[model samples]
Target chain A: MRIVEAGKLALESIWANRLRSFLTLLGVIIGIAAIVATAAVIHGLNRYVAEKLSNLGKGVFVVQRFGIITNRQEFLDAARRNKRLLPADARAIAERVPGAEIVGWEVHATADLERGEHVIRDTDIGGVTPAILEIEPYEVAEGRLLLQHEEDHAAAVAFLGHEVAQRLFPNVDPIGKELRIGGARLTVVGTAAQKGSFLGFSQDNYVKIPFSLHQKLYGTLGSVNISVKAREPARLEETIDEVRAVVRARHHLRPGAPDDFGILTAEGINDLWRNLTQTIFRVALFVVGISLVVGGIVIMNIMLVAVVERTREIGVRKAVGASQRDIVQQFLVEAVLLSCLGGAIGIAIAYAAATLLAANTPLPAEFPPWAPPVAFAVCTAIGVFFGIHPARRAAHLDPIEALRSE
Target chain B: MHAAPAPDEVIRTRGLVRSFAMGSATVHALRGVDLVIRRGEYVAIMGPSGSGKSTLMNLIGCLDTPTAGEYWLEGQPIASLGEAELARIRNREIGFVFQTFNLLPRASALRNVELPLVYAQMPPAERRRRATEALQKVGLGDRLDHRPNELSGGQRQRVSIARALVTNPALLLADEPTGNLDSKTSHEIMLLFEALHREGHTIVVVTHERDIAEHAERVVTIRDGAIASDERQPRPVRP
Candidate 1:
């Protein structure tokens, strides 16, 4: 028989017994759904980390006492062994590194802020030199950013983040408002524009101040985080090496001694992020692989049952001149059609679920254009792999013996 | 030893023997049965239970092979052909009608009638056209869309007849064609067979009922795997 006619026969049989077909395909549906949902979540998270957390921008890097550490014990050990970066390190790097375009020192701590009767506790207070704005640009929603003169004179001027301003001066113009932070009175110069959250952490609940004023108020409360920008992106590696040599010279370390400071660039952070994403993807693949195997077995079991139940039909078809190849082709087509149908349903469900999650939850989901096609190919392979045995059984039946079966 | 059959012979069997292994014993079902059937003949094979008439029918239908025999259909040696070749012969040269109608229950009457044509790999429009014509010939043109369950016993049988005729085979083989029907339905089916035979189709009916066997132009009665009598009636009972 022609493939098209066999396909029609398969469809008729599936439609004839809808509930049985659905029950038989349940395992496949669930397996494919799991795969699709995992792919969407991983795709979205990769985009999120690349955009928000990598901190890798053109010609940018950080010099801190401790690098980005994930393990708690390792972080504590690094903090104890690494010397605090001194204030003069930033100036020394700017003077010595020819590739350095901008050098800035940054520090941050959680502090209580009070403005009139409104008070927000545990608000992030960031101390940064004016040059830090050039290294990590922040959009100004109102007024202007801190000026170079303000940082040189240690002026008590501050920039409120979007959320901080919303909380401190709900209905008033926040640019000229004065707020008390850590018992130091400071005037709000501008409000940074809203930058949404990343991985559930709010990015807008903070304020920026000149590092000179921060030193006077908090008396060098913590190690400085030095932000450096290169003159050109292509020269970032050389700039990092030049800055490392200057810091090593300033610290008076021996030629072979390891430097006590950490250098963090966008490349390092991206490597770390990629490793994390790869681990997640591997685990997801392993889990979905198990489910796929289980699903294939289920389909095989059900196909065997179908073959037995239709023995008489097979006999009748053989009597009507169906060759063994024709019988095998018909059954295989039925199996493949069943799996592909289940895969299509699974894809539709996963897409709907991803959209719902994107709309209502903090977790992000993104659908890749190639996911459905690849998933369908895998499903068809599974069908062929699991279906061959049952189809062969139907093909090998003796016509007279099969017709005698009740 | 019999001479080889002429070109006009549709079925020729010589010294046909079939046996079965029943535990430690070999039961010989057919022993040296010789038979010849020509084209455009209506023949009935009748026997009591366990007389090997069913075995002969199966061998003649190419559903099973004989142990020691030379059988020829349409001048081709069938006993030596392979499984696929036999299947093709069945597709092109034989039409089968069963007492239970044997239509695919879920398929429409039109689809049921199109089975052999589908095996022949005919295109959709042509297969449908031929199936429609066959159903119309059986006076079931309006019931093309109805499923087997939706048709009466007589109509269902007619659909099976239509399926049998759809391929325009060299032989129309019926096994107890009226076994499941009432007397009136049986007579109606017998009349239909009479009409088909008059149309110059080669037909064979296998039954144990003398009344049903009487409808054919010739009757062959078997006893203990051997033909007891072979008679040619001057006129068919149904005619």
Candidate 2:
């Protein structure tokens, strides 16, 4: 018999038992849905991280005491072995490394800002030299950035983030206004541009102060992170090597000894992010694999039952001259149709869910274009893998005996 | 056993033997039966229960292979043919009318009649046309869309006959074709069979009823796994 006829026959029978067919399809639906949803979320996150990291500026790298530590033990080891990065290290790199265009250091702490009757709690505060603005360009939306004379004189000036500016000085202009930071009074020199939140955390809730006054207010015991920009984008690696040598020489390390500081570039950060997402993808795939296997087994069990239930039908078909191959093809087509239907439904559900998530929540989700075709292919393979045995059983049945059955 | 069947012969069997195992002991269902059926002949093979008439019918219908014999249908030897080949031969050479009127219950009479042509790999339009013509020949032209359950017993049998004739095979093999019908319906089905035989189709009807066998031109009786009588008589006309 032709495949089309077989398909029609299979469809008729499946339609005759709608509830049972739906139950049989549930496992495949869930498996495909989970995998597709995971792929969409992971794909979206990957793109988001790439975009965020690109904002770190080209040819710029960071040197810090502890960078990208993953586990508790690694953190402990780094804390014990690494020396604190000081402002003098940044000066040394700026003076000694010809390839280093700008070397800057900054330190961070959490403090409350009070302006008149209003207070913003637990706001991030960063202290940096005037040159840090050249390395990490913070956009000035109002007033002007702090001048070189401000840092040289240890000036009591502050740069407020967009959120802090909006909340602390809502009724009046923020520039030249006085705000108290941890018992010290400072004038707001500028307000930074509005940078949106990342993963639901506000990025624009911070204040910047000159390095010298930050030392007087918060003390110099805390380690600072150094940022360096290469004079030329193409010479970034050479500039990093030169700075590493200068810093290591100042610390008096042996020629073959490892540097205690961590240097991170945008590429390194991207690689780390990729590794994390890949691990997540692998775990999701494992879970999806189990679901698919269970789904396939359910399909196989139901197909076996269908074979037994249709034994007399098989006999009638054979008596009318249906070949063994025809019978096998009929049943196999039915199984594939069932699974492919499940896959299609699953993909639709996953797409809707991803769209909903992207629209309503901070979690990133992008439904990949390749998911549907690949999902259908997987479903077809699963159907064939699980459907062959039952189809063959139906084909090999003795027609006389089958017809004899009630 | 090695002889080739004549061109006019629809079926020829030589020393056909079939045996089955009942527990540890083997029971011979057909023991060295020889038979020949010609084109356009109407014959009945009748016997009491367990006398092996059904087994002989199964063998003749190509539903079972003989254990130790040679059989030919339409000049082709088929006793040793494989399952696939047997299926093809059955599709192309023989039509079956069952006592139960084995029409697929969900299908209309037209679809059921189209089944044999479907396996024959005929295209859809031609299959539909031929199936319709066969149904009209069986006097069911207006009942083309009726399902088996909606039809009376004789009408269901007529649908089966339409399905059987749609293939236009070399032989029509019926296993107790009127067993489930009342006397009046059985007479109608037997009359249709007579008309089909007159239209030059070879037919073999297997039954234990002497009244049903009397309608045929020839009757073969089975007693103990072998033919007991092969006799020809005048065709009976219904009053």
Candidate 3:
């Protein structure tokens, strides 16, 4: 018989028992739903994180005592003899690396600042050099940034961030006012242009002071962090390598001793975030994939019961001259049809639910182009794999016994 | 001993023994039975219960393989044919009507009759056409859409007979075809069988009822798993 005729017969048999057929398809529907929904949500999260990391300055690289990129280091000791790259080393790289522009180091700490009645406590205090406004991406809004003369005398002047300036001198100008920091008082020189938010924290809240005044006030408590800018995008990797080698040579460390400092670039951070989410996504897919196996088992069980229930029908078909293979194929077709139909429903539900979540929730989802078709194909294959035994049993039935069976 | 017959001999059996394994012991259904039947002959196999008459009917219908036998059906040894080939033979050459009116309960009369032809792999148009003709011949053309549950017992039997005749097989095997019918309906079936026999179609019927067997000219009596008598009344001329 033609394959189409065989399929028609299979459908006829399935229609004969509608309730049983739907119950069998139910198992497959749930299986595909779980996998598709979870993967879409995780995929969205991965995208959102990469977007945040790339929003920082163009080709910016941070060298700190602890990794700001992929790996987490417990210790922060760039002071090791061969690890610490001083301001002298920074200047040498600024002149040596061809496409390198300005390079500067900054030390970070929490500080309490007071002006008359307004006080800001536990605010970020950055100890930056005179070249920070150029090398760092901090733009100037009002007054000029600290000049080279100010750094040589270890100037007591400070640059207020936008939030701090508005808080301290509501109606008055902050560029010429003096504010108490940690203990000593310093004059405000300039305000940084808006940097917006990074990772969830406001970047507009930190205060920048000349490195000499920061050291004069909090020398024993804080460590140093460095930032560099590349004149051209192509020279970034070469610049980073040059910094690494120069820092190591200044510290005079032996080979193979682990470097105490860490370097972070935008691309490096993006990769780290994807790696974390992908692992979680795979684990979720596998956990949900178990449902597919359950669906297949359910089909096998139902087919076997159908074989027993329709023993007489089997006999009637055989008595008329159906081959063993014909009987088997008919039943197998019924099973595959059920699974394919069920799988389509599953993918639809998954997609609809994912779309709903993406629209309403912060974590959005995106389905892969191949997911629906591949899911349907797998469901059909599973049906055939599980439906064969029952079909064979029906085909091989003896006509006499089957005719007699109730 | 058996003598090989020509292809025209519709059914020939010699020393055909069929035994069933009943628990630990065996029950012999047919013991060294020898018989031969020809085309266009209306033969009624009559016997008492436990006389292996049903066993012989099943063997002749190719529904069961024998324990040991030399049963040749239309020059083809049925014992040597595999399961599928036997099924093919049954479809092409044998049509059966059981006493219970064995029709698919859910299907309409037309669809029930079309079943055998469907298995024969006939195209849809031909199978449907032939099924229509067969049901019309049995006088159930108006009841084609009605299921077995909706039809009367006698009408149901007529539909079963229509199913048996649809394929135009070599022999119509009716096992107690009228056993479940009232006398009036039985008489109607007998008239239909008579007409079919006159139309040059062969028929074999198995029944214990003497009155049912009297409708055929040839009657074979089986006893103790073998043929006890073979007798035939003189041929009556058609009107």
Candidate 4:
């Protein structure tokens, strides 16, 4: 039989038994919906993580004593063995790596700052050189950034972040104001503009001061973190290798020995994010796999019942000269049409659910454009897999016996 | 077994044997039967219950394969044909009208008539046109959109006849065509059959009723899985 005719017949039968058709579609609907919604959530989170990682700076890399620790045992082991990064290590990298643009180092502590009647507790107080601004590139909203001569003299000068400026000197110019930091008074020279937040932690809550003064006040409390900016993004790998060689040489490390310190870059964070999303996607696929099996089984069961119920119709069709292939094609089309209908509905529901999640919750969701077409293809595959046996049964019916059934 | 049938012969069977397994016992339904039917002849096969007339009809209609026989349809050896080829023969060479007026309950009369053409893979417009013409020929042009249940018994039977005739088959095979209808409706259906036969259509009606069989130009009676009598009538009874 022609495909158009088979489609028409299939539609007529489905319309004739609407309730049974709907029941058969339920499993497929839920299966596809779960897949689409999970994909959207995962895609959204991947985009969110990418955006956050990008803010860590383009081609910017950080070299630390212990690195961004991901495991407890490894972190403790690294802390026990690795030497703390010193100001000399930063200077060595700046001199050796020709591809490096600006090499900056920083050490921070939680110190209370008091200005007139306002006292902000546990404010981020950091020691940095003038080059830190070029590495991190924080926009100065007021006054000017610190001068290199200030760090040379260990001058009592500071730069306030946007949050600290608002907290300690609200409604007044923060620049040129004296703020007491850890019993040392420093004049604020500039206010860094807002840098927003990362995963709910405010990035604009720190204060910057000269490295020499930090050493005099804190007295070697925490290890320093070195920030390096490559001349160009393409030169990042070459600059990192040069820096690694210089730092290792400065520490008198032997050849073929592992570096005591750790190197981190935005690419590492991207790799970690990729691994996390891959795990999530796998779990989602497993769930969808189970649902598809259940859905396929349901469809097979219902199609078997349909074949039995329509035995006489099958007989009539055979009597009218319908070949086995014709009968098979007809039933297959019905099953595929049923599955595709469910898939379309599921995709629509998933889109709506994703939209709702992105709008109403902190969870980010991105509905991929390719999702609907891929879902439809999977639905067709499921139908073909489950529909064949029943269709063959209908096709191979003995016309005389089938007609005699009822 | 006899030799192959002539080209002009629409159906021929020789030494046809069909057996059934009822548990351990093999019952012979058609034991060593020979039959022949020519084109443009209205014939009826009559028998009592368990006389194997239905089995013979099934073999003749290509609905069943004989266990042991040489059967031919239009000079082609049907016993050697595959299921798909047999279906093609049924579609192109035979039209079946059931006693139950087995029109699809949900489809309108017009759609029911279009069934065979649909399997033939004709385009939609052509199938519709042919089905409409067949229905009009069966005097059911005015009831094109009416479903089976909405039509009277005679009308339903007429719709079945329309469905059968739409394919313009070489033979019109009816299985006790009036068995489910009342006497008046049965007479009307028989009259329609007579009209079709007068138009030079080769028709076969299987029945146990003598009155029904008397309308055919020839009658063959079966008993104990064999032909008991075969006779020709000069003047068949009018409906």
TM-score of chain A in every predicted structure: 0.94, 0.94, 0.72, 0.88
Residue-by-residue lDDT tens digits, candidate 1, A174-250: 88779998778999899988988876788899989998888887788589999999998898898999999998888
- In angstroms and one decimal each, the interface RMSD of every candidate reads 0.8, 0.8, 1.8, 0.8
Model 1 per-residue lDDT tens digits across residues B1-239: 34678988999998899999999999999987899999999999999989999899989988899989889999888999998899899889999888778888888999989998999999989999999999999999999999999999999999999999999998999989999999999999989998999999999999999999999999998888888899998795433
- Residue A108 displacement (Å), model 1: 2.1
Candidate 4 on A120-229: residue-level lDDT in tens? 89988889988887777878999988889999999999998999999999899988889999789999999988987654577888899998889998988678999999
TM-score for each candidate, following the candidate numbering? 0.92, 0.94, 0.77, 0.93
Indicate the worst ten consecutive residues by lDDT in candidate 3 chain A.
Answer: A73-82
**What ordering of candidates by TM-score runs from best to worst?**
2, 4, 1, 3
Sorting all predicted structures by lDDT, with the top scorer first, yields 2, 4, 1, 3
Q: Per-prediction DockQ scores?
A: 0.68, 0.78, 0.46, 0.85
Which window of 10 residues has the lowest lDDT sum in candidate 2 chain A?
A: A128-137
Better of 1 and 2 by lDDT: 2
What is the DockQ score, from 0 to 1, of model 2? 0.78
lDDT of each: 0.88, 0.91, 0.81, 0.89
What is the Å distance of residue A143 in model 3 from its true position? Answer: 14
Estimate, for each residue in A153-257, the C-alpha lDDT of model 3 and write its tens digit.
988898888888888889888888899886788899898777665434677898888887777877744546677877776778988887777666666657887
What TM-score would candidate 2 get against the native?
0.94
